[model samples]
Target: MSAPKPSKRPIRSYVIRSGRLTDSQRRALDEHWQDYVIDYEPSALDWNALYPQQQPLTVEIGFGMGDSLLAMASAQSDCNFLGIEVHRPGVGKLMHGAHQAELTNLKLMCHDAVEVLEHCFEKESIDRVLVFFPDPWHKKRHHKRRIIQPAFVSLISSKLKTGACLHLATDWQPYAEHMLEVLEQEPTLINHCGPGKFWDEPERPATKFEQRGKRLGHGVWDLLFRKE
Candidate 1:
């Protein structure tokens, strides 16, 4: 008999925490979902056909409630934006904001971002990827569940075009260090800052959560790596 096959580990970058939805959020999901939300699919996506014009694309993973994403989309009409989050309330909130802003360049997916990148995105198809304030999974035993491991970075690398940037920010110091280490080891990526260094605070609008953390004296670390 052959040696026992290894069991496949689940890819769990997030724990789905159910939050009660506001009436406005429910209204947004009911009314505006078709305009912005993309259901999860296993097939590759044709991004050019999705938007009105082929332009630089940015995908933000785990955008909490989407205040910053809305800001970016509003400020950058030349780029199309996609936001992936497992939280239904966040998705609905983003949709409401997008509709209120009359944004034509934003889309959303309520699913596992890792799965979306693996199955829906073609290699070298994305212009920029943003992962801001991902769950730190701070416990030693839970570190494996953090999203910035080598394999995940490799998969992210495959989805980015040459010279495209992967920007990550975290409020947790150890997790930031881990992100830096993993991103530095990716052969296909070149650090925007030199090895072992962190990037300066970027110009993107600050999210409410980030502002709250800042008020509490929490430090933020940013990492920018380019596909090379």
Candidate 2:
């Protein structure tokens, strides 16, 4: 008898919403993309080659409209920042913002973050990773599509250096709890906020999405875990 094959992992963590792009955003894609964008390939990226100096590398996943990411990168000149987002408009907007700010410490990838972690980032190459306000996928059946699963956390843990951090934020209570459960179960990660606790709001500026969520009375939760 033939051996059983391994089951294929799910490829999607988010569903792209249909939001029309402004002309400026589209124009940025054409004119400024080469300056700020990193083309995704199925090969490991060299962090030292990508930036001028060998400083700490931080990557933010799903940076919606990139307001907070732009602010953080602008404030932190010594550390290099890379962002991965599936939305073309967000990528273009961030590119434009980074260019306008004259920021040299930032780069971007327009692709699924999971694939990027699996292929483009070598093991223990990342110093810090951020996942802020990811889609909650609120429906019970769609919960499987949420990104904070054991396998996903494990993959992130593999890419983080020892003592490096993984920071996650969510406005949805259930998803935040789920994230806590998932991260705690990963033996390679230790909670910086203590076991089963959430962190205070991070120093980064708030994205438009987060601001809107806050205006509606939704509470936000942040989780910071270090690689053990």
Candidate 1's residue-wise lDDT over 14-132, tens digit each? 88988999999999999998899888889998988888768899999999899999999999999999999999999889899999999989999999998999999989999999999
Model number with the top lDDT: 1
Cα lDDT of candidate 1 equals: 0.92
TM-score against native, each model: 0.95, 0.94
> Which residue pairs show collisions in model 2?
none
Q: What is each predicted model's overall lDDT from 0 to 1?
A: 0.92, 0.91
Worst 10 residues of 1 by lDDT: 201-210
For candidate 2, lDDT tens digit of each residue in 38-129? 99999997877988767999999999899999999989998999999999889888888898898889999998999999999889999999
Q: Roughly what TM-score does model 2 have, to 2 decimal places? A: 0.94
